[model samples]
Target: MSLSGKEGGCDCGAVRFRIEAEPVVVNCCHCRQCQRQTGTAFAVNILVKPDAITVLQGDPAPHEHPTPSGAGQTNFRCSDCGTSVWSIYHAAGDGLRFVRAGALDDPHAVTPQVHIHTTDKVDWVAIPDDMPSYEGFYPGREIPAIMGEDNAKRFARAVGRG
Candidate 1:
């Protein structure tokens, strides 16, 4: 489905944004770093091409933090409310963005296509039986199957793999 024109903002409404295109994929990450960063059991991130999102209002500040890859990640948060809206992993450079799904005006508009880093998930957390759960990152070879042919091509192009 086309997710174009979907709007969202920070908690304080200082930063507003619009999605200009359909997302490549949605990932529910259960890694310890994801839990600690979000202060939750898991983090739902909407993956899209860098240009897919457009800022409608306000400027979000970027904050860099450590990552397993040592290349680090940059999280963009509202300057006013300090609500993280999205992130750019150094590994992906400027190719892709990991938008916080919870920051969307209609968070439920998207659902996790895959669950990653499940090995570090909290004991009380349970993934649905039908969801694709991975102990670590999902295999690159499985992208086509999980994201469909079109989205997989988009993803590959976004990450410069195509």
Candidate 2:
């Protein structure tokens, strides 16, 4: 399903955005960093092409932080509300954006297809049996199986993996 027109914003509505293409993948990251950043059990991020997303309104502040790979990532948050809107991971490269799914107008618009960094997950957290869960980050090549052939091809091309 193409999510070409999906829109979202920060909590205070100071920032708004639109997604011009279908998401490449959806991830539920249970890493400690993710938990700390989200202040929750996990962080739900929707991966999409960089140019596919458009900021319709407001300015977002960027905060850089270190990732598990020792590489850093930058989170774009609302200037007013401090809600994380998206992130750019050094590993994911310049072509990808990890959008905060909860920032979408409909938080449930996208559902996570995979769970990553489960090795650091909280003991009380429960993962659905049907969804794939990895103890650590999964191989990038596995996108095809998780997001379908079309999305995988697009994602690969976007990330220079194709």
Candidate 3:
């Protein structure tokens, strides 16, 4: 919590949040779960410390799902606008949190450090080789380690490898 960053709110401005610490990783997930939730080919996320994230305005409605990754993660959304705002996975450590990238005041400032769950990526989308890709949900372990083992499960779903 040594650093402080700009803060912003949800679409309706009813729910607000601030990230007091620098983010650990910025992500663009192409997982089916994320696609379904976002209704888009990919979803952007910013992983930060749970303690560093504070709700400055209102409470967010949460949607919990028992993911196959073996970690119990719940997605927090803005109830007023049905916008996914953040996610908290118990396995990631009590201090970790994942914020929706679009909610940032300067969304463009944050870029994807990794492209996760690429196996489920939409057929029409293109992936840049410069970034990392994964098949399964990255274990909520340390971000750096999780980002690399993507090598273990690198099959592309578009080709039907599973």
Best by lDDT: 1
Cα lDDT listed for each candidate:
0.90, 0.87, 0.70
| TM-scores vs. true structure, each candidate | 0.95, 0.93, 0.77
Please give the lDDT score for candidate 2.
0.87
Model number with the top TM-score: 1
The TM-score between candidate 2 and the true structure equals 0.93
lDDT score, candidate 2, position 47: 91
- Tens-digit lDDT track of model 1 for 65-141: 99988989999999999998999988866789999988999997878989999999999988999988899988998
- Please provide, for model 3 over 1-162, each residue's C-alpha lDDT reduced to its tens digit, 9 standing for 90 to 100: 222576866888888988887666667888777888778898888767667788899998878877656777788888898778888765554455678878777776677877888888889988787666667555444443643444222212111232
Order candidates by lDDT, high to low: 1, 2, 3
lDDT of 2 by residue, 4-58 (tens): 7989999999999999987888899999988898889999998988888899999
| Candidate number with the higher TM-score (1 or 3) | 1
Clashes of 2: 0
Candidate 2 lDDT score at position 95: 85
TM-score (C-alpha) between model 1 and the true structure: 0.95
Error of 2 at 44 (Å): 0.8
